[model samples]
Target: MKKPELLVTPKSVEHIEDLISSGADAFIIGEQQFGLRLAGEFSLKQVNEATKVIHAANKKVYVAVNALFHNDRLEALDEYLMELQRIGVDSIVFGDPAVLMAVRELNITIPLHWNPETTATNWFQANYWAERGAKRAVLARELSLDEIIEIKENSQPEIEVQIHGMTCMFQSKRKLLGNYFLFRKEAMEIENRKENKNMFLHDKERKNKYPIYEDLNGTHIFSPNDMCLIDELTELFEAGIDSLKFDGILQSDDYITTVTNLYRQAIDAYFDQGEEAYEALKDDLLEKIEVIQPPLRPLDTGFIFKETVY
Candidate 1:
């Protein structure tokens, strides 16, 4: 099996060098106004600078324009895409079919990485995207290992999976956070009360809570625990995944460095010495991840083992 490319989300230009040094083979840089992570968005100038940095290390950079676009934004989107193509961006990751069509219509030739943001659960979906000019498909986080293996076996496009990071459980375009605060303004002393900076939601029925955040795309409710697949590198490699992605846009630089290094070590160990070495390093890697991850954030295997309920 070919060794999977190690992809990482670098929130800023400052993180690019460290990410490259940490063994990242490629990066997914968020667009300033059109990416999922508003907090991690980069200006066009920053994107240009970041691309230079990533290319200097001989690694690739994929710009994230994965937000669903509206009719009003089509002109701007076309212009932005042309600008990206001019700057030699390696690829554009997008979720909207209209945007993909726009890219094609504009004759923008940078490869597309289709991230439908939901429901890329099978090989047929991957093949569908491949037939439509997508070079890669970021698989949905809801699939199990066996399902992923099946998709890899049947798909035509290169497969990418989020091996470590937050799993978004819910996403909506409405400004829920703003509306909530507005509605509650009269219920309490609005002006004097501090906004709940550390925002989260507790599910009474599920007896769990998840991190919540709002941005240009809307409100996102993430899974209760961050996904940690440090122990499953061998499975992913054997399954023929083309890339393993680390999502750290919302995490600290130290956290990104530690997790990236852990995965890097695990991937290198597996490819060089085989499964036994990979297994032997699991505990040590997990310990390090725990140490570096935010104290309050929990880690779990995510939906890799069990199917997510509909």
Candidate 2:
């Protein structure tokens, strides 16, 4: 089987080299205004600079132009796509049709990875975008293992899945958290709300505390446990997944690099020696990841082993 490309979101432009050293084959990054849930924002200049650096290392860079746009925001987007093309990025990850329209109107040639998050669940949806020009389908995190395999087996575009890091559960354009604080007349700074990594919403019924924060995209919430699919890598690779993404949102650079290296080692082991090598290393890798991950942010297989809602 061909080895899957290991993709990661860098914490910042400065962290790109470290992530590259940790064995990341490709990176997904963008400014906050255009990307809904990014680890950090990069100016267009930074995107140009970083793209050069990535290409120098013989790695790929994918810019996120995946935000839902307003009429006002649409004006700047066409130019942005053109600039990205000029910089020669490997691909653009997009959710909104406006981005695709802009690309076509500007005659931009950069490839697109369709990442509609929750909505990209089945083969028909995957092919619809592929037929329109998306080169890859970043499947929904909610898909069960069987569903993911089936989709890959039938879908025309290459498949990408999140193999590690936090999973976003909710997002909104309204500043819900800030409004709540305002309702209570609490004295909270806007920056505090934007950078509040300690904030969470507790679900008493599920007994889970979802990480929550507000940003330019408004309010966003994450799953209770970070998704760690190290154990399931074999299945994904064997099934012909083209890429595996590791989100670095809400994680320290050290943590992100460490976790990435662990996966790197595992991927190399599996491909170099087959399933038996991966099996022998799985237990030890999981133990290291358990110790390395933040105490509050637990790890699980996400929806891979769970039943999907119809």
Candidate 3:
């Protein structure tokens, strides 16, 4: 079986060198002004410098411009994209059709990676983007391994899947966190300062608590548990996944290094030895991952084995 490339999200410029050294095949960098990852944003100069560092190491960098665009941001968007192409970015990851349209209209030659949030759940949607000029499609987190296999067998574009890290359960353009707190203060007639704070939502029946935060893009509710598919590396590779993405844009450097290294080791083991030897390394991998991940933060295989109901 062919070994899949490991794609990682760097928390900052300081974290770039370690990630590259940890056997990451590519790095996904984003800026706060235009990308979805507000916390892990890098300045343009920083990104340009980082691109040089990554290129020197013979790796690739994909800039995340995966934000929904409004009419006002078009001119700036066009200019920024030109700057990215000039910097020699490998491709741009996008979720908005308008942004895709803008790229075509401006005649930007950089390859586009389509990630239409949760819409890429089947082969038809994957092929639709492929036909429209997307070089790759990041499959939805909601897909099962069986579904992904079918899509890969049928789709034309390269396939990318989130093999590990935090899975977002809800995303909204509205400032739900800020508005909720404001309404509470008003209804109770209390004076309070507007501050951005991390909040949690509790589920009595399931006894689960999920993290909620707001940033430039909007409010986001993430799954209580981070996704971990270390044990499934062999299966994913066999399924023809072109790339495996590790989502840790908001996590610590240790988290990024440990996860990337673990996946790197796992992938190497699979290709070097085979399935049985790879299975033997799972316990060690999980233990190392547990040490670096946040205390009490749960981990699971996400929806890879089970189906999700609408």
Candidate 4:
């Protein structure tokens, strides 16, 4: 619909390099998890390792530093952020406002893409980040189609959407069952009760015994959803969005291929024939894509224009 562009956002540079070798136009490299070091490029000797390889293949790279980090980690982040800037990382995607401001303070900068986990849903929110110096903002996974269009129309920065992969239930960085699993199991004697709620179990059977995470207001829920946007590619492009992204760090190559093919075919078909062309190929498209894990709730269109879910 709009100019066809593909952004390969790998969990790290290894997968990104692999995707580049395969056929990705751009990359988003995040090193925070590994302590803020570029994966492939080791030292000054490997100066060109990241930039040269990707540039040689005619690809772009966006270094994601940290969506969430403490004030203490700022000095540690400087060197990594500086390296990305010096190497001219195409853009930077971050969730923390402090990180955003710190990058600007670096004096050497490029496009700053807001991480979706930060939740810029409405255009006013999107544009707020734009004015604060973000180049592109990944629309929140919860936004509806209409909301996406509205964001595109109003936000000054370029917009990108995650068209495929696991949709996270909590902020990318948050306390989780990781602690609940660790502490609750060991210290709580109730977990060892002869007849119990079975809270130790990972999966549920009966609704009454269901393991629901309770928040102050209610229960906080998280489920995996396969994002297959092939059916709506045309409308999105026509809406003036800039990029389509895929989420597949946990998927196999075949899964990635299937996701890629459907979107690619949908885009190609729209220009070649009409909207009907993609519809004609819809069955095969749907067939190629299968959900490894469906949301416990059900398949949702996602928040392109409305609230995440009722």
Candidate whose lDDT is highest: 2
Runs off by more than 4 Å, candidate 2? none
Stretches off by above 4 angstroms in model 3 are 186-197
Clash-forming residue pairs, model 4: 142-303, 143-303, 143-304, 144-303, 144-304, 144-305, 145-304, 145-305, 146-305, 147-305
Cα lDDT tens digits, model 3, 183-274, are: 77663321242333346788889878787777767778888888899977777888879999998845778888878999999988888888
Q: Number of clashes in every candidate structure?
A: 0, 0, 0, 10
What would the per-residue lDDT of candidate 2 be over residues 1-310, giving only the tens digit for each residue? Answer: 8999999989777899999999999999999888878887899999998999899999999999988788978888888888999999999999999898888999999899999898998999999999999999999999899999999999999999998988888889899888887888874665465667678898899989898988777788999999998877878988999999999898899998988899998899999988899999988988899998888888998999999554
Model 2 steric clash pairs: none
Clashes of 3: 0
For each candidate, C-alpha RMSD in Å? 2.4, 1.2, 2.6, 6.8
Once fitted onto the true fold, the runs of candidate 4 whose alpha carbons sit more than 4 angstroms away are: 11-23, 34-50, 116-118, 172-181, 184-222, 272-274, 291-300, 304-310
TM-scores of all predicted structures: 0.93, 0.97, 0.93, 0.74
lDDT for 296 in candidate 2 is: 80
lDDT of each: 0.83, 0.89, 0.83, 0.59
For residues 109-184, could you state the per-residue lDDT of candidate 1 as single tens digits?
A: 9999999766888899999988999999999998899998999999999999999988787888896777787887
In candidate 1, position 96 carries an lDDT of: 84
lDDT for predicted candidate 2 compared with the true structure: 0.89
Give the poorly placed runs of model 1, Cα more than 4 Å off: 186-197
